[model samples]
Target chain A: MPPPLKAVLADDEKSLCVHLKNLLQQAWPELQICAEARNGVEALEMIEKHHPDIAFLDIKMPGMSGMEVARRAADMCRIVFITAYDQFAVQAFENEAVDYLLKPVEPERLARTIQRLKERFEKRDLDPAPIQAVLKSLQGRLAAAAPPPYLKWIKVPDRQSLRLIAVEEICCFQAQDKYTVVQTEREEFLIRKPIKELVDELDPQTFWQIHRSTIVNAAWIDKISTSLTGSYVLTLKRRPGTFTVSRGYRDRFKSM
Target chain B: MMKTGNKLQTPCDSVRQKDFKPMSPTLRQHRKGLSWKDLGLTALFSTIIAALLTYVFQDESFWVYLIISQGIGLSICTLCRYSLALFNPQTSWGIVAVVATASIFGGMLGGTVGAWLSGIEMPIFLSKKIYTLRVLIMSLLFGSVIAYYFFSRERLSEIRGLLQEERIQRLTSEKHAVQSQLKMLQAQIEPHFLFNTLSNILSLLDSDAARGKTMLRDLTRYLRASLAESRSQWSTLGSEMELVGAYLNIFKIRMDERLQVHIEMDEALKEIPFSPMLIQPLVENAVIHGLDATIEGGTIHIRAEQENGLLRITVADTGQGIASVPSPGLGLANIRERLQALYGGRGRLIITENQPRGVKAVIEVPYATAP
Candidate 1:
């Protein structure tokens, strides 16, 4: 049998890193884990020092991002990125032909990535062209996937025709059973969905999650008020009045 | 004209009466319409006119001198009122005109009394001279008054036009600010959502490819809804809940038995409108900030009710609660700002600890039946 392929695992979560190392050993008994790193900077140093044939990188790290390390260590070894965030940066990984594993990494997916890496290594002339194409496709998909950032109006079903709702006129949203009720200064409507799914499509920075199921538009929070019960609540400048801040979310008021 | 004047006077008098009814210490300083600088200027002008009249009539009898003094005082008073009309057009001109006329009449009576007291015979020529001086003074006073009126009126119109222009500029800037914020919000939501969904897809590819395929279809639907409503300020409650359900379904696949969601809402509130994507972020926070930190997983509860004329929505989670790090996060901050912009002071959001050990958020908005 050919000599074991040497590798290093780099991730912030100690347990996850250990688990991945164990899986690598089990899957390819010949693969040896040369080193382990908790962050991107350490991963880079370890990769440079040991010069492992493969490196597993976690996308988010304390000091450096996984992409930066991958870019720098491109010539040294094969790269596999592990991420909790998948969609936004898929194209980035695709462009480099770097393998990526979404967190909580599964054994089957990890094995497939390893298999692909082994095949490329054996060929020696692994063209990055396919990866580049994938990246281009991902970019196109992303562009075509969502509405343009400048959208100003949303259409909701009214009596028979669609009613146009101006974004600036909405007040807040309330979750109903299997639906989300939208409250504006003028009217209300029931949409067929839950709150969690909508968040992926909405901007997190603009619409804040103040509670477990309540998201408020940042523009609407007039001032944060303290209640008689020693809890904090948000007072909006709009038509409807005060909203209470659950004790769990009180930490959000430390900056206020 | 009289009726109009009476109507105007009633409001003005009412305002003036209200202003003068109580002399609160805090409001005392602002009571006087004329500033110290204006009073000082008026006094200075009166003194100058008095001195000039005294010098011009030094050789004449006291009676003639008094008449000349009256003429000069009247002329000076007219100048002061005319100057005021030119400089400060917004204030009532009636008061200034009355004061100038009173001063002229007072000077004439004083001069006549002084002349009679001095016992100087008034020459017929002196009367002619007085009349000529009065004519000249009146002509000069009226001429300046008319000229000042038109000049100030023209200037006032120009200033009013400028103020209107400035107001338009301010409104435009405010609109731009709102639009930019909307754009930033759009950028933030899409990427974060996409990233999370893609991660889920990746995880599902191994064990349940069929489920993964369904998730993809759901994702496409979710994306389309998001894109369609991305720029909208508000959406129907029903639509928002649909989006939330889609998110839960996706998470249910990944979280399995660890995640549970319960929603409670009144049926009558189905048509209520609210900001788009409002509830989703809160649900997301429950997952990412609360449940994600724990291994045991948790349950999220959403409740909505109408109180008084307002709709109140609440989201509760049974998890580790908020992190002790004390950061509101960009997502929360954005929600607050958006609420403020949309509802001014009418909408509100609150976050608190749940009964057992989780986080609960409440959102309150005015209830309107139709758009």
Candidate 2:
């Protein structure tokens, strides 16, 4: 008979690790758990030491993520990601044909994963192409999972009292030397965050950077016309004056 | 002289005049009615028209012609403004129709008023046997051209405005739908507890039925309470505490002596309105992240209090220090989102290293009675 398969399990939850081991023992009695790790950093060390046939990993762990571990160790062993995210991002993993065990892994599902692993092992197949492709796609989706929620309201000093202005009400943000000016239809206020930071935090679809120092709300834009000087000017619906679209940002108004 | 057509006053002038008397003295300067501006402009135009007519006809009594011109100009300007300001003609065709009709009637009324004020009955002007007939025909043509030109210009901008307004409405609704969907997903009682807890209970059911039964009961209660709160997005601090009790009970059963939980809250402050499932996630973080990592396990303290007009909830675990604040998870992200959605700038979550050992998460929200 073929030698029993050796596997490593890595998860932050100690109770979960114990439960998973018990289930794995029941489902695959011949399987050997050579090492157990409670986080990603230890998982890598254990994988290198044991060189197990398979690695089960929790996607989120303390020092490093499972994705990072898989990237470093996919050549050494097959990877099965254990994830707690059932949000929109899990679909990416499923679409890429990578195996994943959802949090509170069910025995029935774990059995299916073991069955697949056994088939691959019996054939002596160690091709990592599919796994690598899945990892690449997953990297993109994981990066997209949470962009810290945008600024909802900004507190600015009004003439007498601080006025809380809704971010949506802002027509544009113009950068000064040290601070940025938040302009609405009626008045402007100074804020500490730079234009660069605002560009990263604001939803790109709603706000567009038309100049090096100005970010305008797309909804308030009234018209975009080429000036006699051959530069583009953006007029706003409620606010006076126009913003010039610099040569670098001319591509933004190409369709208009 | 025709530039005045673009600067014609609106029907709001009449409405503003009626309500002008009742406004507070302070607002009168900023919110002035347009009647004065229109009146002054009309008088100026009439004087110009009178001078032009006298220079052309060299009439014996220039004063009489000037008075007549003033009456006619005032009537025509007021009539045109009233007709044009009632409703925004959305379509190009509708704008044209309204402008044409208003122009013709305004010219006819002005001619009649002009003749009456000049001491000549309008019947002579309309009799079709005088040179005044030619002048009337000329006025009608000029008025129609000017009104149509002005309104067509206005229509171009109006169409653009409507399209933009429609787009804004559509985008706003789409944004609302997306936000509500995110809220639902964030507030959902996650199934992470389901399969694992059930599996654990399954193992215990055969060996330790009493413990398994207690765990099952607590899990069911926690799920039920969470599901109920998720539907409404809120609950009283008292009920939320009951939910937390059920939750910690399940974990306690799972870990046995490895987990210790201490919950404290004043009875008087229990009825204060609070967001549900918020503190429980932090408590779960304490147990799973802080205590689960330590070999000996440790205590998790859940405390809620009213301090300085704010509701403060703290989850402190005596296991590890801030070294193991698990990478950003959905639970932490959702907690931040729910707080922001509920309280704007007033709600805050603070994480700090507790003295002696472990991590503390403090959540403060505006204190208020149940809605």
Candidate 3:
């Protein structure tokens, strides 16, 4: 009755996703198998499309890591991070009371996790605040190890040849399934770089993340208006579509 | 009086025993004993003194003056050698006493002997001139001057020897610290790598048993090669390549079909004894920074060539490209340091950007020079 209790799985490795999916069916047979994503961009898209009750996120993946996706997902779904083995990730998850599954996930462990998820959703007392805290701390730990390098130029595959696009020319970035559409004032081009990656690479002061899938250049904004739903919607100076600023990121907009 | 010299005998015996063993045949005449070499040197030195005294007095023969000078010289020289044993070198008063006793005693012995040989008779003692308080006091002054010179020179040289020893000790410890630092760097087989490989092995065992067995074999070889190599200064180029091969093979399984490796090395060059960790870190850098950073992954090409009295080994990768790769400071710096240490300036590590994509690292070391 209640949407058949859906869940989404995400990992770069196809076999790993399949393996986890098979194990998940044994643990929660009643749960509907909605979708599986091979990368962080696809994972975020699946979460948005399905509005699933849970997401099994692999912490390490190219383009966008599971932690980055989790940061953008906010309160969208309950997160159960899967890591091969990261000491800092393990400690952060434990301290934050966020669930994490080590690789080679045993059936018994999966059953326990499924049971906990069912109980939490049934009670509906689970909050997204600790997930936010855990992810922030993990980011800090990762940055301390090696600061994320700023990207100045990105290579975009063109129709017949390749084009090197400078970061300054880009007005906004919007996620399109697995690829990101890089919008410049002159023209819009598509790139395989997910929105999550641009968040790390682009200068945070100029390019602001207004949506899980959209990041807009601050100088190119038409205006930010508060919708009747009390959420901020931003439109670019030359760009057409209005980008919704989710509640998780609205604080950055409201203060400005 | 002479029996008491036995107590003062030990310290001098211990010190001089190690040096000039022939001269110190015995302290049998600690009061006035000398080896023939000592006697000849003493006779020559005393003659110089006797000439001076005879020139001043102008009354006695140089022979009579020589006997007195010889008595004082031999007595003071032999006794001063053993003198410090009875007294602390730290005390001035103790030293004056040693000098006074030896000089005056010798003056009396030689004066009395010379007076007897020359057939002079006296009321209570022979040669009142030699026994005069003036002569005894002068003997004490001259003995003190000579004693100060001897001790000062000895002390200066002892201090110099200590300073030399200290310098050698400091240099040895500095060498030790560098050695330990190298050992620690060598033992840096990343735990994350080990755990990740093991985790993959566990997963594969359940789903793909055949691949699991292959990974296990590769892992075993990797562990053994690394463990054996780190403990030794050098390993054969072939074994090191085997170690690198095992390492990449494990990574291949873990990365799925993403990783590709091509190793080109001459069979003749494989027997060359190369520094243990030189090429391994460069390969690791290629895998982690050059290849692992990209989702599509890439290829690692390792080639070793021997030519013109030099061995050149290069590890080039095509994954993220050189522009995308950040400077991997520690691993590369470590390799350079090792190269410098093992081959001095003869060894070299050169890094360049690989065309199309990735990074190329080359190591050059003299083939004829090895550990």
Candidate 4:
């Protein structure tokens, strides 16, 4: 028998994730599923923790996208992307000859993917360079297609009137008590906008999401301190209190 | 009018020429009756030809020979028109042969009969060979010249008819080009939405047959609505709403609980000639750009009303509040262009921020009936 293998799967939809897990189990009973994640962020943590031989990722998720995750963890394992239907993503994958499964994954197509994965995995084809080129091209294509002007200003209630706060002035955003708390130098005001949407609206270069409920401005970071329990806590320049980087977000602070 | 003749002509043969102008068939096999007006035209042309011949030959009785020669000319014309099925006339020489044949037949017949009639005395031309030969040669020259004139007149008219048909064909093609350009302005389908919906249906087909069937039905309706009306530039408000309704139903099933919709339309405005594709694109914009951008999703409200001879439509949404980057065009420009193409400066589409959040697009046009 081939050496035992482990794989982790990630998808935002709970039903779809379960469906894929079931399909994978049926296809290869001996292969073990070490972990499962509901989004791109958790998928990275699971891959890091389990050191799996393969990762099955969904291309779209709320906070972090699968391509972004693949860019970060490409050297760790072979990736088989799951996408409902994305023109640029599919085109890039086709160009790089990468493995991708269309949604409602047919048994026949999945079998083909399995055969390819087993062959490549045995050949020790864990090179991250070519896959990185595909992701870069895909990113360029998506940017050229949308070039979406990211959210620049957010409004929060200020006394009797509404105020438009420049996104740069804001230090952090956290979801609390069914409302989002927008943090600035002189303000910690509440707004109805949720963190789920802020992940998509804010530019990733300037804003880094460190927790499910929190996002911090990269320029406002004061320092990263390690705790005895082996957790990372982020200290900001303007903000008074520190925020604990969650288990899934520790990779952002790993280099530091 | 078909009774008068000279005494030398046998009674039966002269009667045949006078009364039996048989109907003839054209090249296409359609029968043409020999009408009195046709005969009158033949008589008029014969008189003119005879008058010219009289001047040249100095013979008073040449008119009778000209009239008699008309029969031979008419028969030959019918044969030429009908025999095209047997003969190829695309070559220039073939049709000019019609003039040649008519000239030869006209000269020989006119010389034989004209010599007999112009020689009104008791066989004087038979006694003088030079006189008979002179009259025969002169008649041949004059008959050919006269027949060639009529043949050219007929050819000129045929060329004019051909040119007229070519002009009509050019106009029709120009109209077709204009029509196709408008259709190009119609909605271009987004491949992402199409494939995603198809994938969703594939997934649901096994798990929930009933819901899958419902989605299939809605998709069929949506396709029928969109594809059928695309050929036309104007549609009834009621039918356009039906298209929007089918479109919303498909999304409602796919998005499930993430989407909410509210539509309000008056019954009387349904039959008015509204611009096609204006509302559906706006609704699609609201769903894809306004609601789908946010995780929690939101509601799309479509309202149409007719007030004071004006039809007004609004599609509003409560999603990202237009504060987010607008979708690629979102069919906003298309909607505006179609309205302008239809109404000149009288129609308008306006975009504004929805109450507390989202985007609201409105259209106003005169409630004109079908023109």
In model 2, which runs have C-alpha deviations exceeding 4 angstroms?
A: A1-3, A81-119, A145-256, B1-67, B70-186, B192-215, B230-234, B245-264, B275-303, B308-371
All models, DockQ values? 0.05, 0.15, 0.05, 0.05
Per-residue alpha-carbon lDDT of candidate 3 for residues B157-257, written as tens digits (9 for 90 to 100): 55874564454434433344355345534444577677667767776776788988998999999887776566566678988899899999987876667
Q: Evaluate model 1: give its TM-score.
A: 0.44
Clashes of each: 91, 0, 1, 1
Model 1 over residues A156-183: C-alpha lDDT tens digits? 5656544434445455666887778766
Q: Which regions of candidate 1 deviate over 4 angstroms?
A: A1-57, A60-81, A84-256, B1-177, B180-189, B255-258, B293-297, B319-328
The first chain of model 3 has a TM-score of 0.57
Candidate 4, lDDT over the whole model: 0.68
Give Cα distance to truth, residue A203, candidate 1, Å: 27
Return whichever of 3 and 4 wins on lDDT: 3
Q: Model 4's CAPRI class? A: incorrect
Q: Model 4, B1-371: lDDT tens per residue?
A: 11222222233332333122211111112123444754565556655655665666684566554643444344443443344324434334544664466455554554455456544453664566755554455445444543465457446755863464344334433333344335433453556566566666666676666876887787777776666566555678988888898788878875666789898998887887765577888888788767765556689999998779778898988977544553335645455555655675678776666768887777989877773
Q: Which pairs clash (backbone N, Cα, C closer than 3 Å) in model 2?
A: none
Candidate 2 TM-score restricted to chain A: 0.61
Q: Could you tell me the lDDT of residue B278 within candidate 3?
A: 71
Best by DockQ: 2
For model 3, residues A1-256, the per-residue Cα lDDT tens digits are: 5657888998776556767887888778998879998778889999999998889999877667888889988688899999877888889888988888987777888888888888888899579998999978877765654543666556676564455454555788889999999877556788887899889878798788888988888866655655535577676654567778987888887765
Q: Residue-wise lDDT of candidate 2 within B1-371, one digit each (tens)?
A: 11222212232233333333222111101112237866786677667766766677774266655665666556655665665455334334554565566555665676567667777766665774542543354355445544654566576655865675555544443344335434544544555556557755765665568977888998888887776665555578988889889888887865667789899999998888787678777777787678765656689998998888898998888876534232344256556556766786688776656656776778989888864
List chain B TM-scores, each candidate: 0.55, 0.51, 0.52, 0.50
Clashing pairs in 3: B321-B358
Query: What's each prediction's TM-score?
Result: 0.44, 0.54, 0.54, 0.50
